[model samples]
Target: MIRHLVLFKLNEGVERDDPQVVAGAEAFRALGDRIPELRFWECAWNISDRPIAYDFAINSAVEDTAALQRYLEHPAHQAGVALWREFATWVMADYEF
Candidate 1:
């Protein structure tokens, strides 16, 4: 399986409660049902307040690189990425396990 993980940090001056952030989060939350390649999904606001911590996280799994690619290319996922691009910066990692 491929494990895909991501961490997000809101742009400067962007509040966690901002409508854009909330909407972006909701969009991500809805992906599990819409994307068949997603075998596991867990996206959420980070509970940690540590200075080094990111504001949000996405932990998901897929069958393989092909499934991961399909998930990345899905229209819903693309929309969510665009929404997040407006208010946040993120980092991701994918590995086979």
Candidate 2:
């Protein structure tokens, strides 16, 4: 099993409170249902880690890193990333067992 997580901070030019950000989060949450390899997925808008520098985050679980790699290269993910880039300023990550 593997846990892959990413955190995104949208540019100041984009609205942090925008509905689409929320929508995108929900979209990510729904991917586990859409893609079988994804054991679970969750997207969050706020974090209590007050000193951190991320605006939003995506946390997902997969059967393995191979599944994650396949998911990363999938067309649906490409489409989703394209949509996500519109609101994202910088994206960061943390991946592990």
Candidate 3:
């Protein structure tokens, strides 16, 4: 399986409570039920106030590279990405276990 992890940081001047940001976050949160490629899914906002901390995170598992690719290319995922692009940036790491 592949574990796909991502950390997201909101753009400067963006607030967590902002309507668009909330909608983007909800969009991501809803993906586990909407996408079958995901064997596992978890997303949450960061509670840390540390400067090095990201504002949000996604921790998910998929069957393999193909499944991962499908998840990446999925329309729901793309929509979530488009929404996030407007207010945040992200970094990710994928590894097999």
lDDT of 2: 0.72
lDDT of 3 by residue, 10-97 (tens): 9999999999999999999999999999999999999999999999999999999999999999999999999999999999999999
**For model 1, how does the per-residue alpha-carbon lDDT over 20-54 read when each residue is reduced to its tens digit?**
99999999999999999999999999999999999
lDDT of 1: 0.97
Q: Candidate 1 — which residues are off by over 4 angstroms?
A: none
* Model 1 per-residue lDDT at 28: 100
Report, for all candidates in order, the number of backbone clashes: 0, 0, 0
- The lDDT of model 3 is 0.98
The TM-score obtained by model 1 is: 0.98
What is the per-residue lDDT of model 2 for residues 13-80, given as tens digits with 9 covering 90 to 100? 67656887666666666676777777778777765657666777778888877898888887767666
Give residue 15's lDDT in candidate 3 (0 to 100): 99
Indicate the worst ten consecutive residues by lDDT in candidate 2: 88-97
Q: Each candidate: what lDDT?
A: 0.97, 0.72, 0.98
In angstroms, the error of model 2 at 49 is: 8.2
RMSD of 2: 2.4
